[model samples]
Target: MKPFFVILLFSFLILIGCKGEEPLNDSIIIEVKTAGEKELSDLINNRNGKYLFLNIWATWCLPCVEEFPDIVKLSVNYKSDKIDFASLSIDYIEDKENKVIPFLTKMNTTFSHFINGFKKDEALINFINKEWSGAVPLTVIYDSSGKQVAMLEGAHTYDEFADKLNTLIK
Candidate 1:
C-alpha cells in the first residue's frame, strides 16, 4: 500500500512538471473588423484624447510584413494612454477572418485592426490622403485633436518610428 501511494505521488509530480504552456493560438484572440472610407475616417477623427498611430498595410505586401514586428515593438514600448496604436489591412474584406486576423494573431497584436471595405481602392486612398498614391506600409499619426500631424509612406525602421513618436510627444 505504501509503495503504491509513493508511486502515485511520483506520477502526479512528473505530470505537473511536464505540463506545457497553452498554445499561442488558444491563448491569443484577435479580431479584424471591416472598415470603409467613412468608417476609417471616423476612426481617424475619433482620437479620444490620445494621439493615434495608424499603419496601413496588407497581408500580401512584403514591406508591410517586414516592418510589422517593429510596429508591434513600438506599440508595446509606448505608453498606451498617451498614444494608441492600430493597423488597417488593405487585404480583401473577405480575408479579414482567415488571413488578416491570423496574421495579426501571429504577431500578437491586440490593438484595433480593420480590413479594407471600400468599393473602390481609389476612394480609400483619397480618403486617407489624396497625395498618398495608394501605397502600403503607410503610417499616419493624428494628434489628440484628431488632426493629421504626420504621414509617412513606405516601411520604416524601429528607430525611425521612435524618432517620429518622440517628436510627437514633444
Candidate 2:
C-alpha cells in the first residue's frame, strides 16, 4: 500500500512538470506571403462576394499570441468557401522564416497568412486602416461587398471572437 501511494505521487508530479509546455512542430511547413501596401490594396479591392476576416498580429505580442488558437479555430470553422479568413503578421522582414513560420506551424494556422513586406511602419499601418494606430492583434471584418463592418483590437477569447464573427457573418 505504501509503494502504491508513492507511485501515484510520482505520476502526479510528472504531470505537473509537463504543464504549459507546448511542443514546436518542426515538420509542418508553410509559406507566409509578403504583403506591402500594394498587395493589401489588391486584396481589399479584389475580394468579391465573400465576407473577409483579417487579423493583423505579430509573434512578439503576447495578446496576439494568446488569441491565435481561437483565430485558428475560427478560420477552420468559418472557411473561405463560405467566408474569407486571413492573417497578417507585422514581424520584421528578417523574422518571417525564423519566427512567423515556426509560430504559425505550432498554432496550426493553415489559412491565408502574410508578413509585412514594406519597410515603412506608418505607411503600412495607414494603408491597412487609417484609423489603426499600428496596434497588434487587430481584427477587421469586411462584408461581401468589400465594405468594412467591424474592427476589433487586442486579445479576444474564443467566445468573444465567435460573437464578433457571427455578427459580421450574418
Candidate 3:
C-alpha cells in the first residue's frame, strides 16, 4: 500500500511539472505558400461558405507595412465560421523565406498567407480586379457565393475593417 501511494504521488508530480512547462517556440511553424494567378482565381471562386477577406500587400510598400497590424488584429477578432482572412504578398517569390516570412512572423500572423508567384504583374493585377490600379494594401471582401462585396484600396483602421465585416456578416 505504501508503494502504491508513492507511485501515485510521483505521477501527480510529473503531471504537474508537464502542465507548467511551455511549448517550445520552435514547435510553432509558419509556412507561407506561393500562389499564382490561377491559384488566386480558384481561391476567390471557392470560399466554402465563408466570407473571404483578402488583403493584397507587399513588404516593400510602406502603407502595407503600416496597415498590417490592424489587419492582424481583425484576423484575431473576427475569425469565425462566418468569415475567413488571408493575405497575398506581391513581393517576389524569392523573398518568401527572407522577407515575407520574417514580416509575417513579426506580425505574429497565424492566418493563411501567400507570396505572389505570378510571372506577369498585369496578369495578377487584372485577375484580382480590373479597376484596381495595381495598388498595394488593397483589401477586398467576397461573400459566401464568391461575389466581391467590397473593395477598399488603401490603408484602413481596425474599426473600418470591423464595420465592413459587421455589415456583411450581420
Candidate 4:
C-alpha cells in the first residue's frame, strides 16, 4: 500500500509540473482551445496587467489563412512580459477537431488559440464589436486595463501588427 501511494504521489507531481506552460522552441504544432463569447470576454477582461493581442479569424477565410503565419511569427518574435497574444477562430464548433485544429497545427502556431463557441454568427460578431462588418480577419488590441487601444481589419503585415502593438506597449 505504501509503495502504491508513493507511485501515485510521483505521478501527481509530474502531472502538476507539466502544464504545457513552457515556451515553444519551435513553431511546430499546438492544440487550440474553445470558448464562447462570455468566456472570451472574460479572458480579455482578465488581462489587466499585460497588453492583449487578439486576432479574430476563420479557417476557411482566405485572407485569414494567408495571414496566419505572420500572426504566429509575431507571437514568437514579440514574446514579452508586458504583452500577450491569442487567436480566435470563428469556425463552426462542430469543425474544431476536423478543420480548426488541423489548420492551426499546420500553421505551427505557438500562441494560445481559441475557437468561437457562439451558435449564432451575428451574435458573435456583435459580441466582438458591433461596428465590425462580420469580417473574417479582424484584429484588436487591449491595453493593460483591458480597454481596447487599437484595431485593424483585414489581413495585415507583420510590421503592421508589431507597429500597432508597439504603440500600445509604449
Candidate 5:
C-alpha cells in the first residue's frame, strides 16, 4: 500500500511538471514568396498610382504585436481601391505561416503577407530604410506617386494611426 501511494505521488508530480512543458509555438512555418528578381518590379509596377501602406514586422517584437490591432482596424475601416495595405513579416522563411501566419489569423488581420527571404539583415534594413537600424516594427506609407510620405517605427495607438491615415486620405 505504501509503495502504491509513493508511486501515485510521483506520477502526480511528473504530470504536473509535464503539463507546463508545452512546446513554444514560435517555430510554426508560413508559405512566403521570397522577393525574387521580378518581385520588386511586380510590387512597384503593379501598384503604380495607389497608396501603399507597408508594414515590416516580426513575431518576436512586442511593439509590433501591440501595433498590429490598429493596423487591422485601419484596413477594415478604410477599404478603398486607392489604398493598398501590405504586411511584410521579417520572420524566417521556414517559419512564415507557422509562426506569423497563425498570429495574423488569430488576430483576424486582413492584409496580405510579404515575407523577406534574404538572410542578411543589412539588406532588408537598407532596402526598407537606410537608417532603419534593423528595427522590427517599421511602417512606411507611400503616396500615389510611389514616394514615401511617412515612416513610423514603434507601436502606435489606434487613434494615432487614424490620425496618420486621415492626413494621407485628405
Candidate 6:
C-alpha cells in the first residue's frame, strides 16, 4: 500500500508539472512585407468600393487582446462580397511566430494576421490615420471608394462593433 501510494503521488506530481504545451502569450504577431510600398499602393488603388476594416493591434496591448474575440465574431457575422476584414498586429518582428502565432492559436482566432514591420510608430500612425494618436486597438473602417467612414479607438463590445458594421452594411 505504501509503495502504491508513492507511485500515485509521483504520477500526480508529473502530471501537474508537465504541461502539454508552452504557455500562450496573450498577443498576436502580424507579418509585414519589407516592400510594402507596392502592396499598400495596390490596397489603396484597388479599394474602389469594397468596405475595409483595418484593425491595428499588438500582442502586449490588453485592450487589443480583449477586443479580438469580438472582431472575430464580427467577421463571422458580416460575411459579404462588399466587406473585407484585415487584422494587422504591430508586434515586433522577433515575436511573430513565437509569441503571436501561439497566442492566436490558443485563442482560436480565425482572422488573418499581418505584421506591420515599419519601425517608426509615427509613420505607421500616418499610414493608418494622421489623426491617430498612436493608440493600440485602433479600428479604421473605409468605404468602398477608399473613404474613411468610421474610426474607433480603444476596446469596444461586440454589440457596438456589430452596430457599427451594420451602419456600414446598410
Better of 3 and 6 by TM-score: 3
Q: Write the per-residue lDDT of candidate 2 for residues 1-170, one digit (tens) a residue.
A: 99999999999999998885656764656788999878877776677788778899999999999899998898888774457788889899799978988889888777788898888889887876789878788998777777888878777888897887776666
Alpha-carbon TM-score of each model against the true structure? 0.84, 0.79, 0.82, 0.79, 0.74, 0.74
**Candidate 4 residue-wise lDDT at 35:** 79
What order do you get sorting by lDDT, best first? 1, 3, 4, 2, 5, 6
Candidate 6 structure quality by residue, lDDT tens digits, 7-73: 9999999998885675544354334433244554455457757788878788999999989888877
**Number of clashing residue pairs, candidate 6:** 5
In model 3, state the lDDT of residue 130.
94
Q: Weakest 10 consecutive residues, lDDT, candidate 3?
A: 21-30
| Per-candidate RMSD, Å | 3.6, 8.3, 5.0, 7.7, 8.1, 6.4
Over 1-170, each residue of candidate 3 has an lDDT whose tens digit, in order, gives 99999999999999999888673344546788789867777788888898899999999999999999999899988876478889999998888888988788888888889888889899888878899999888999999888999999988989998999999999
Q: Which ten residues in a row have the lowest lDDT in candidate 1?
A: 20-29
For residues 1-170, what per-residue lDDT tens digits would candidate 5 score against the true structure?
A: 99999999999999999888653443433344566325644664576678888888889888999888888888888776477888888888777757877787666655667788666878767766787777778888878776778888877787887788888878
Q: Candidate 2 — which residues are off by over 4 angstroms? A: 1-28
**Top-lDDT structure, candidate number:** 1
Cα error, candidate 6, residue 60 (Å): 0.3
lDDT (CA) for every model shown? 0.89, 0.83, 0.88, 0.84, 0.76, 0.75
lDDT tens readout by residue for model 1, 47-131: 7788999999999999999999999899999965489899999998878877888789889986789888889999888888888
Which pairs of residues have clashing backbones in candidate 1?
A: none
**lDDT for residue 150 in candidate 1, whole number 0-100:** 93
Spell out the clash pairs found in candidate 4.
none
Flag the better candidate by TM-score, 4 or 5.
Answer: 4
Give the Cα error of residue 32 in candidate 2, in Å.
0.6
